[model samples]
Target chain A: MTNLTAQTRHHLVTARVENKAGVLLRVAGLFSRRGYNIISLAVAPTDDPAFSRISIVVDVESNLLQQVIDQLDKLINVVAITELDPEEATQAELLLATLARSVEHDADLGVLIQSAGASIVEMTDQATTIQLVAEPTVLDDFEEKLRSYGISELQRTGAVALPRLVQL
Target chain B: MKLTGAQALIKSLEREGVEVLFGLPGGAILPVYDPIIDSSIRHILVRHEQGAGHAAEGYAQVTGRPGVAMVTSGPGATNIVTALADAYMDSVPIVVITGQVATTSIGTDAFQEVDTTGITASVTKHNWLITDANDISRIVAEAFHVATTGRPGPVLIDFPKDVANATIDYEEPGELELPGYRVASAPDERSVAAAVELIAAAERPVLYVGGGVIKADAAKELAHFVGLTGIPVTTTLMARGAYPDAEALHLGMPGMHGAFAAVTAIQRCDLLISFGARFDDRVTGRVEDFAKGAKVIHVDIDRAEIGKVRRPEVGIVADCRLAISALNEQIAKNSAAQSRDRIATWVERCLDWKQRFPFTYEGAGTAAPGDIGRIKPQFVVEELRRLTPPETILVAGVGQHQMWAAQHWGFVDPRSWVNSGGLGTMGFAVPAAIGAKVGCPSKMVWAVDGDGCFQMTAQELVTASSERIPVKIAILNNAYLGMVRQWQHMFYEQRYSEVYLSPDLPDYVKWAEAMGCVGLRVTDPKDVAAAIEQANAVNDRPVVVDFRTDSMEHVFPMVPAGASNDEILVHPSQADQPR
Candidate 1:
């Protein structure tokens, strides 16, 4: 048996479900009934016919992932599920944050952000909006990397993914 | 005519052309329930208030209309928060109506009284606490308009119990006037010009289309632009089916778990034209390395989205369809090199990459002699692909199997693939499949689940059986939550935890049979085809095919989140080796 806490690794998953009513309930019910704490989730349908894709990011043991997959398959309208390989997939997520503009003028703050892979997307007198697109871990690193520059408000788009292989 | 707030609520809903409302009846909502019984609107009694909220979300998502969810105040309203937040993040249009304590009991902490409006304020697009019956009609109308318009999201309207019962002379409100809220429609001239110039001058350009195209219903226009400009396109997870998956220029999803070719293209492109896509973390690992060579031009309807990621060379705050149409018009006038050769080179590169590390699974065609055998998840996905129609909707639970589905399932259409992509909800498949089956009754729907996740809400199988929703469930029973187990094996020195379910297998199957559903257990790989065939035969009720798979199996081609996309872990067992 895997040590639940010691073996657990956080994963961010995004799925596309048919754009129908009640699908979200079914998805959430599955997690809650199973006593899974979903750290964050973002769901929306694609531009295709009538389908909605939900992105759910959570933490669990790697050894027990199969059980999770099997349980997910039981949901009626869930068309497909993908547990993104943090190492192989080209994952990107959006973080829309409004930082106090007072710090934007700080030379130290400007240098800190530039080093953290973020840029000032918008600047207003009250807030300086910064945008960062990176892996969840890197984003975390960048967040820690930007502690010197205070963050007033923040919003994340959660994670979305595509594979990363070079074409010939 | 004089009417109660409840009656006005119903009228407002009817005026907005809402035919169905997903919710549950409770004490606080008795007044609304009374009027609902007399109204033409049909109410679906969900098993849980949370289910009602998600159901409304599903309805809104499928129909592109505002979903209506009604419930009692306090816990009922609170229970629906998850779905509300889900809709909020995904931009789904849903209106949640809750019954509050009587107006007289404002801050007295009456029985079942809670500050639901304040509780949901951060999660909803807008929320209102109505104390007066006369304001019901206007509030309801405005709620629907707000929820459906702009970047669609959930809206909440809390009605006091007395307000629902209070009688008043009602008249539909005039046009909604919210001066502070304005979604841009037309593209700014300078940005459009800059975008056109970027597209015209580029030797290698890519159109990163997103759900906004589908949201705007601009598929034809998007397709037209891709065809005319010969620019390759890649979609975000939410933008699947924005363009035909089979299109020559189409590079599949680009992000964590997206196609490699798409990522490489993003990395190598000279110019990137983004339509309705916000740069999320899953798509941009090590942000500085994201699209290192490209000049990005972002066009979106939400002004807040512009420059929300990498600073765009040209940021146009306008509807994608309008922007694309305007660009098409301008491109027609500007005589510039189409650069067909460059576009062709990129396409060739993508095709070559796809041929290299093709998303596939290898089966040894061997099974151990036991109740739990070595059945590969890929075989199930592959077999289902063969048996089901190409357009069949396949939903999956979160875990190792979900990754297998993404790798093995050949998605021919957009929306054909659905799951909890961002949240990674494990037990999402069964109910999502039910919703898909409900949305497209004529189409085949399959809920691909794993053993651990399947047992989470297996009770839903009873609902499918009783409701006569013929959803086919293929359980990838690896006995443990495989993804978690793999992590334990690789990172934690294989100290197994709660991942094993050796004693629970038989009970799970027995439970399915008791629910009046046909249950088939597959211990042998050879029986996979037959089991699927038998499950398909059960048209009257839901069918479960439990394939006992090897617990040691793992999802490969993994790119650890913080690492660069190029750094991949090819297999679960070999964690130290980077591909």
Candidate 2:
């Protein structure tokens, strides 16, 4: 087995691909065929709408890193490929956690949400829904905070990224 | 100009320089056939859709251009599955166009409404479903482009019946926008330097060649490098003719059933310079034990293939021609010729191995009068090699005969040998031979097939006969799935399950005659050459020579499946992989 900690790590890989039918399949196919471990993938229309931007967080082995980049770069549908470095990129993901109404302390959960930098989106007799938009790592920790509240359902968007702009 | 989708597609194929198309038409593809009848592209009507597909593969293997196949929907699409899979495995370029039900009737379960593109997606490099008539030309062009570029694989374009019937304004797509496909990659300078250093320093080095040499058309450059560097070359099955078999540096083959010396050289060599060849399981045997002593310098056009199997000391992802030529220049500049004397001892050792236990079978072409009933199949192959011209492009169906053809044929240049290498598909020879003959009309072509393989696609002879494609077929009639029987005999306690077909089955000669081919049967060893001569003389029609061979014989220098190349079992009793 490959060394999980050493070989697997989150890499922000963005691909600008033709906005056409089956383009997503092609990108997904490349990932599967090449055996790259994609932690998360998000595809959406770019600003121009002529092409789609596919942001994938891959657990890329250091040895297979160049190969992964080369393979992804060669797909005809993929117009451009960029692997955003952690030092140079900003990343974000959204999480929505629906907590069951059976929580022991609803007022305490509101205080916990305020302290954890989250907001209550909906509250009803059935459930209390909380939404958090933050860095992927922050959401991962926030999920642990919601665990004691007896969350019934949870949904999280895959990480989306862009290179950080600097005035310098 | 205004044109029907079928006309536009045909025009696009012609624009892409397609000379011939192999296909079987049906209701869905009838409109396309109408345009093909009048177009400059010659259409060869095949007996089965499978034949058309394999024939196209053969054509592409020899020409380096994508073979074109056009078949109707449903059964036609499914029939091509094997051929497409074969191309996918071997990286042969092919463009298969299958017709589909009309756009409205696609999901309505109308007659012949099969999801051709969906079914073929996994097997092909890419596939398209053309619902609009306007997309016909661009789709055809892109299909050809995608099929030929990158790793070179079969691509499919599904043409719905209504789309083919619809009229639209057609303009040829000026250029394809395939951002992912890479072509003609040059080797990295550092990697080349590393490879050159290894090649220069090694006293015992071997040059391993594979099908990519032919694919990249780098045989000439490779031969030049080997000649200048005095390196011994072992060509793999797919790369049989990439270097001259008669050359002094040649090491016939280097895997299971390969020459004892060639296999030994690989095992003992200090440096193995691999060019355009993957270390396939068949060649490497047990991967852990293969080339245990050699440090491999692997070069190929595909980057992912570099360390996919055996990790190389130096891996260069570049076109074989470009890499070899650059290496040639570097070697010439650096005076790498100084090491010729150092490699002399190694060359002599390889030569001694070749001279001592050459790939030869006992009683080959020299059977006694009493042994007339037992015609050696190897002898038949040797005789075929002797009788055929030097330029003969021999294609073989997979099995014992394919090995024999590879072992005995005198291949001197690239494209002179064509076979299903990676897939090892049976029933590939007949149609492939026809396709090859069609592609290289001036050259002699022969289909060396086994009885089992012949039975699967023998109907193709009718297509060959009808089209006047005069390729010869040599059926080594052992009355069994020869290789499977040999395996059962060698390892399965001789249980011989269902390997044998009844010897009293349909006569191949009569079957050949029924298909308008000149048929002959040679029972004795002495008659082998004469029968082949007769078959060769029948230039006006296709000929089938049924040579009944001894079923007891088995291919030697056997590595047994999954055994290391070095753990060779020359005879059946010494089976290497008993487990």
Clashes of each: 128, 4
Question: What is the lDDT, from 0 to 100, of the residue A77 in candidate 2?
Answer: 72
- Number of the top candidate by TM-score? 2
Which residue runs of candidate 2 sit more than 4 Å off their true CA positions? A1-13, A30-39, A57-74, A82-88, A102-105, A164-168, B365-373, B571-579
lDDT of candidate 2 over B26-81, digit per residue (tens): 99999999988789999999989999999999999887888999999999989999
Instruction: DockQ for candidate 2, please give it.
Output: 0.43
Ten contiguous residues minimizing lDDT sum, candidate 1 chain A: A1-10
Clashing pairs in 2: A74-B180, A75-B180, A76-B179, A76-B180
Query: Which structure among the candidates has the greatest DockQ?
Result: 2
Using Cα atoms, each model's DockQ against the true complex is 0.02, 0.43
- In candidate 2, residue B78 scores what lDDT? 95
The window of 10 residues in a row where model 2 chain B has the poorest summed lDDT is B570-579
Candidate lDDT values, in order: 0.73, 0.85
Distance from true position, residue B422, model 1, in Å?
3.3
Candidate 1 lDDT by residue in tens digits, A55-105: 777667665454465456434356667787767678777777776765546
Candidate 1 is scored at a TM of: 0.72
